[model samples]
Target: MPPTRPHPRLRYQILREQSPSWKTMGTIAGVIFLTTTPLIRPRGLVGRFPNLHCPSSKFSHCRTTANTATDAPPFQVSAAASSPSSAIDEEKEVTSSGNVGADDLLIVGPGVLGRLVAQKWREEHPGCQIHGQTVTADHHEELNEEGINPCLKGTKTTHKFPYVIFCAPPSRTSDYSADVRMAALNWNGEGSFLFTSSSAPYDCNNNGSCDEDTSVVPIGRNPRTDVLLKAEEVVLEFGGVVLRLAALYTSFMKVDAASLSVAILKKRLRNQILLGCDNHPLSRQEVMDLVTKSGKFSETFEAFTGTNDPLGKRLNNSKTREEIGWEPKYPSFAHFLESL
Candidate 1:
């Protein structure tokens, strides 16, 4: 009637098909895009996307910038974590504190080497206490004269020593391991325990080089070897050190030379002589010749043999030298003889 409005269906169809103005269309499109697409605001978005950067204008008024706020803390590294060798060096420094000191020594058997060690300790550390154990009563006065307190066998000691050196040879009747255990009972775990063992544990008959890490030759059924090995075990159990000495010789002990000369003398005099095959064999004429040439009642000769001897490998002391920084005063038999 008034403004004959087009039919309602026709009006709806015209509005749907008609294009809107540019500004109106742009506003409508922007509203739909914002709702559908994510609103990437710089404020909370920094935490979600840590690696991403925000525009300077977006956070210009913010107190903490995204780059400064999201920076990682500095890393801290430890000495042990950085180098394993440094850790080992520190451990060695700690363990090396067990080195021998004045007033800390106890010698089980104050024999030649024991006396030497005691003398050296006295010379180095004057007025320091050093105790020695001996089976012989006669050695008491001598040991006292040399400034060492002598302890008789089977004597009980109320004092605990920091260093114990066992120089006793393996006994014929007593258990060597028991002896070592008894001696080790004196240690308070504050210092080192050293045992003077023989290189016999390592047989050169096999013609192989041996070190501290080498496997010891089997003792088989030999009771003596078994006892020695047991003694070594007892020492090692106590965290002790074993010094496998070679054929020990000194200026005083002429056992090696005296025994040979005594054998020759008994044989030459037509006297009954008990000889072991371990002695160097010599013809009767050779013995006579030695006696005649020397013209002395007693003659001493070193057994110099060719390389044919299977037991010729020298005892290696590299472990002692490197570990304990020890060096022999007399390095060789000849040096010992020359010194004498």
Candidate 2:
């Protein structure tokens, strides 16, 4: 007549289906058992549920003895233990290759940009050797004054540097590619070799943005562009880096008030002056007319000559900044001019 009780096995089945806390309690019990019995290996049990391995060394005793997930104890199961071996390998590689120290840099040309680079490098890395190479002996005294060791090309030297930066202009060298090859030969493939080039090789008429992956379409048979491309090819062949610079300006080249006045006076004698209108977004004729009508140039201009290259696109240095983590000290020519 009284209500009949459910079977014990049926009650357990109801509990298993209705509550998840029992499973959590089972896991906690397993962990407690594993922690208390250190001598008993849990490899067989751990091998059944491989996902339970510990994530890092901070948790559990698994950090000391666990090399594989199956060998780790129940208490040691975390996310760190389940990480792939490739991550460990990459860390080792970085540790071995990314060790650059003092006395590791050499600059091929110590001209305006080169000198600025040297000064900046010295500021970042004190007590480092910075050797500057110059073709002419005239710059020797000046280089020495700047605390840069002047080295002439083809001079015998036993010193091998880890980093080589070629700042030489293509116009100055007879064969720019040859110069780059010579610099690469000096490098034993230990560190990076960086060559400064120009963006003239790329014609950005179609696409305004030009990056490292941009295809180069030279406008015509330009010797300077050909030489720069050749040098870039040589650098790339040696797994080196090429930095294509936009127009460079420095405040140090600023003329004094007296010198500027003298220059303007001397310029009055010239019948015509060349103007680079490639940076402006107007037609040559329009720019010429604007220059002629302008009060300052009305007295001096008989005719204005403009560059053939059209201007609209800008050099996209996104790749350069992303790769080398370098940002321009002077973002624009106007900024550099204003600094003077």
Candidate 3:
């Protein structure tokens, strides 16, 4: 992601440089960005490439192994030098990567979004362990002072665990491969490597309606797809799940987002007329209540790229809702504003 060649040992270098002062809240944003960039790089990549370590588990292990992708990454060191105990434990749990006993999870870049997802998994699977990685001084401090580091807690199993999650966003300045390597180093496959990429990876169709299976060939010229495209390549080397995430809105998180909508509505009211989108003006509390009450509902909205842009149309989540068994709980935008 960086314009220049990456520093290979950047992770260790960063760990040593300001790891002591990495406790302030201000560092969360920076750490989230920094650690994420390495995830954008290719392994053994120089000149703007970085490296890190991943944990081994029953579900996944990223320490190293032979890869057959066009990227041509060398066989990872972990594959050749691991103990027999490092062999995958396939009888205990089911993994997204088709593995058994996914007892460990490596979560990269812990923050608002990462926290919600990781917290969700933790709640759903009480038997699993999750470790978070951060390189920002403030985040490092927060992690360290909080005793959240796995090594210190005696949580890391030397050989195997489960899966690893790459929740970092891809950016032009990041070293995608390197971040993944760091997550994979000293590692072993646990189960699968899950990458969270943006929907930008898809080409913007003339009608602006596309899904995961859509062809990306047309998006080559689009700059937004550049980072996610590259990152997807690196993650595919591990042969795991890759999720193209949509614009996210979560209750109990980013409460300010709801307030922002309220402010916009009030401003619009001053203009004498109001028309809200089907999903608009929804507040966190109202949405939560709906889920608590009915627990299921569905809706679709017309999403346009631009107001003057004629090449736009509907973008719905019906597919995801059906696949995940989740439906929209919030109904009326008016109710959203009322609850707010």
Candidate 4:
């Protein structure tokens, strides 16, 4: 057998031909990594920054410390309705122990949408404890004025929150998922952790209609979407909820999607992705005309694309209404403005 053995060169060629190609090996390795690896990873830029421990007095009910850095979302949602469509993302809740208030809320990024949620929430639950987190203490006074206890982002509070709403956009941080994970870690699994996402992740084009089941652009397709999807994944992994809010208009109307999501959460629904958009999705021309008529904008209007560019996606929230018994206070943007 030894004498009949093939040459070393021949054996090498045979082995090489029989083995998998580099591409195949790479594909296998990637699959393994994605499947086994945890979505919550080591903190990126946050870990490098020093911690800014928040005082226990910041919120009389909840105690926590803060991390450095702030998140300012780069692009804004151009056309969003306060009215939101609804969807669901499913997962098991991650349980943890702490003296969390039964109706306590934590708003990570207490921006426009965040504060609105707080205001509406307070109106309903006057005694509920509400905490707001910002990158810096610059807004501490403003938040305090609104009756929300202010703290810094990445704050580790003594009492876990029943509801943790992440409203910060991805623009501010180098690592969006890490921020979400931090928020999730602060939750007590007794209530919902809601992440305000955008419709940019949806793959629909040419102003097509997007529903809860619409396919989202896969990761690696768009860097911006990757940030959001990663954050959403982190939320889902924590058995949290995600609300994909469409164009948000704060000028003449208020959106009820945030309150609707809370309604769903109170129903004890977990692991669902919901869409928040008005029942009537408007076009650019329509918006311009409306603003002009309402005297909200005096700038001269011009149409550059002339119907060439794709219209924005029409988000459908029928399921939200059917499932949660939700209806927008204003049926359409025009109706909302007209009411005033």
Best-performing candidate as measured by lDDT: 4
Compute the lDDT of residue 117 as modeled in candidate 1. Answer: 60
- The weakest ten consecutive residues by lDDT in model 4 span 25-34
Better of 2 and 4 by lDDT: 4
Q: Score each candidate by Cα lDDT.
A: 0.42, 0.41, 0.36, 0.56
Q: Please give the RMSD of candidate 4 to the true structure.
A: 23.1
Please identify model 2 stretches exceeding 4 Å from their true place. 1-102, 218-221, 250-304, 332-340
Return whichever of 2 and 4 wins on TM-score.
Answer: 4
Q: Native-vs-model 2 lDDT?
A: 0.41
TM-score winner: 4
| Model 3 root mean square deviation, Cα atoms | 18.3
Deviation in angstroms for 115 in model 2?
Answer: 0.9
For candidate 3, write residues 152-205 as lDDT tens digits. 111223433345556655441245555554444423443445555554445443
Give candidate 3's whole-model lDDT. Answer: 0.36
Q: What pairs collide in candidate 1? A: none
Among all windows of 10 consecutive residues in model 2, the one with the lowest summed lDDT is 28-37
Question: For each candidate, what TM-score against the reference?
Answer: 0.52, 0.52, 0.47, 0.67
TM-score of 2: 0.52
The runs of at least 3 residues in candidate 1 whose Cα sits more than 4 Å from the true structure, single-residue gaps closed, are 1-102, 250-312, 336-340
Candidate rank order under lDDT: 4, 1, 2, 3
How high is the lDDT of residue 46 in model 3?
Answer: 28
